[model samples]
Target: MNVGIGLPIGDPAALLSWARRAEAGPFSTLGLLDRLVYDNPEPLVALAVLAGATSRIRVQTEVLLAPLRDTALLAKQAATLDRMTGGRLVLGLGVGGRDDDHQVAGVPLTTRGRRLDGQMEVMRRLWSGQAHGDGAGPIGPLPARPGGPEILFGGFRPAAIERVARWGDGFLAAAPPTWAGGLFDTARAFWREYGRDGEPRLVAQVNVALGPDHVVDEARAAMHAYYAFTGRADHMVAGLLTTPGGVREAVTAFAGLGADEVMLYCYGTDPDQVDRLADAL
Candidate 1:
């Protein structure tokens, strides 16, 4: 199982330290959460900083809200970052689910899905130097990877799976239990229909809490807080907190589900908390 760590987008200093530590540790990639109108920094820029701080660890946007930006510009930025990182960038795209997110971007939520599809098409074209006559000229000096960064679509719906098959390199799923069976089935179907004759890459994100029995409650509470803050309380109760196994069971379940890579975001932004989780793993 390939393990990756999440970089805190809300705290620049802590993010830099976490990126450096993750690179120095056993982690394979560094991921950033994306939120445009929120106080967090832009994902691409945050990735650039992470690239400069780490040598081998790959950088990824856990799920950038693609419908909220200019696709051509986003593609150009991604290509530049990929080049700077020597082609170690993964662009994880998603249509924002929260209506407030679109409102903040001045984009109507009603058109998010269509906007995402259109933006992805334009972004792919620009990345491949096929974006001319759309008035956005060429995005020269592409990344070392011929086509550009690996594009992964993030969603659990059937439409999302089909979109990945049509346009993405892979699928980025949420934590297990909440996003296991249905999500995997959709990915497999998409792969059988449109993927190469090999295992399709599947990336998942989960909260991690590692320690003796002493910290189990703290970890559970932290995980609960995460879901509540994200408005995913229903999932937290039904999929996460309903069981006694907690984070460890959740992590093992994700790996057992054939996840190619799993990124763990410690419930809180505490570096010590992350360290505890890592040590336990």
Candidate 2:
């Protein structure tokens, strides 16, 4: 399985130092998380900065919130990023689970799932050089490929998995490997039903921090801050792997579960965190 690392879009100092270290680290991909209505930087913009700063590392929006932005605008930005990155882009999308973000966007929390269903098609058409019905043509600096990027959808419910089967090129499970394995099965079943060949990409994510005694506390604190909007920070923060052994064990487990890739998210963004993860690998 391939290993990737996520850079924080929250704290600037942490993002800068850790992004540089991560660029030099032994990771196959570099990624960012998305959110609005917070002090966090915009995800696509942050990704653009990281892509400009690094070479040979695939950059992506690790589940960009799609329905919050205008569909055509999102497509243009994604295609632009694809061109800027020389085609090293994976667009993992979802209707994010936070109500505040939706409120901030002035869109209803309800109907996002349905909205994304159509949004997916619109983005594809724009990427394929098709114009919107209003005579607005394809966005400039077209994608490096016919389609914008490899599309992956994230969520764990039946409807969510069905959407992945219908529209996405793959599935991204933000849960633990053991939990993600079941969702992977659903995704595979739908892939075959849709007449796709081989397999759809399967990616897993784990929040992590590696260090001596004080690192666990740091990681825990970071998790609480990072997931504060989730309303389940206490439950979510408990999953972080703080030791090298735990990290190795989780990687092995995810590989066993047939994951195509797994990304490690560092909440605190200490430079040592990236180096230690690289050494652990």
Candidate 3:
């Protein structure tokens, strides 16, 4: 199993520092969380900086909310990042759930799933250089590659699983064990039914903070902040808080469940937090 670290997108200096450290850490990849019109910096721009800063670690957007932006523009940005990163970009995408997030983006929250699906289709066409003009002629300049970055779909719903099987290169499972089990099973089944070879690549994100003290209070505080930001407190409680053993156990569990990669977010921007996790992992 490959391990990756999530860089805090809210702090530019800290993000850069963490990227530098991650290039030398045990992690094989560096991930950035996406939040438009929130405290977080733009994932694509942050990734651009990371592309220039690191040479080896793969850069990923743990997820960028697809329904919140223009599909063609996003494809261009992702392609540019992939080119800049020397084809080391993994684009994880989702249809956002938070109403306030959509409000911030000035888009309606309803039908986000449908919009996301459409956006994905359009992006694939644009990336593959098959997108056509209004009269069905070839469109403008294409992405650096004939196909764009590897795209992964994130969520634990049945529809999400189906979407991943139909259109994505892999799955990004985010729910706790109960929800994740069903989603994984569904994804595998869909892959088999679609005649795809092997299993789809799975990437799981878990909140982690490592220290000798097993800081439950700190973990809970971080969970609260995550909930406050994402507004999905109820869905994440069990999987979000962790002791040292819990962190190890979570990693073991995800590995056992066939995750190809795991990205751990250490809940805060403190360098000490990153150091603790680096030591623990």
Pick the lDDT winner: 2
Report the poorest 10 consecutive residues by lDDT, candidate 2.
8-17
Question: Judged by lDDT relative to the true structure, which candidate is superior, 1 or 2?
Answer: 2
Give the alpha carbon lDDT tens digit for every residue of 1-281 in model 2. Answer: 78998765547556656667777877877778787876677888877777787777888677899999999889989899898889888898988878888999987899899899989888888888888768776665689866778888888997888777788888888898879889999999998988888888998898888887576677788779867876899989888888889999988999998998989987764668889999999
The lDDT for every candidate, in the order shown, is 0.74, 0.82, 0.76
Better of 1 and 3 by TM-score: 3
Candidate number that wins on TM-score, 2 or 3: 2
CA displacement after TM-score superposition, residue 108 of candidate 1 (Å): 1.3
lDDT of 1 by residue, 1-281 (tens): 88887754445768887877777777888888787656667888888987998889999998899888877778778889888888999999888777677888899988988888888777777778774455656876576677778988888678877787788888888756555656877887887888457756888877554445434455556556445657766566344222225555666777788888888754345565456546656
Where's the lowest-lDDT run of ten residues in candidate 1? 237-246
Ranking by TM-score: 2, 3, 1
Tens digit per residue, CA lDDT, model 3, 246-267: 7677778888888888788765
**Number of the top-ranking candidate, with TM-score as the measure:** 2
The collision pairs in model 3 are none
Residue 11 alpha-carbon offset, candidate 1, angstroms: 2.5
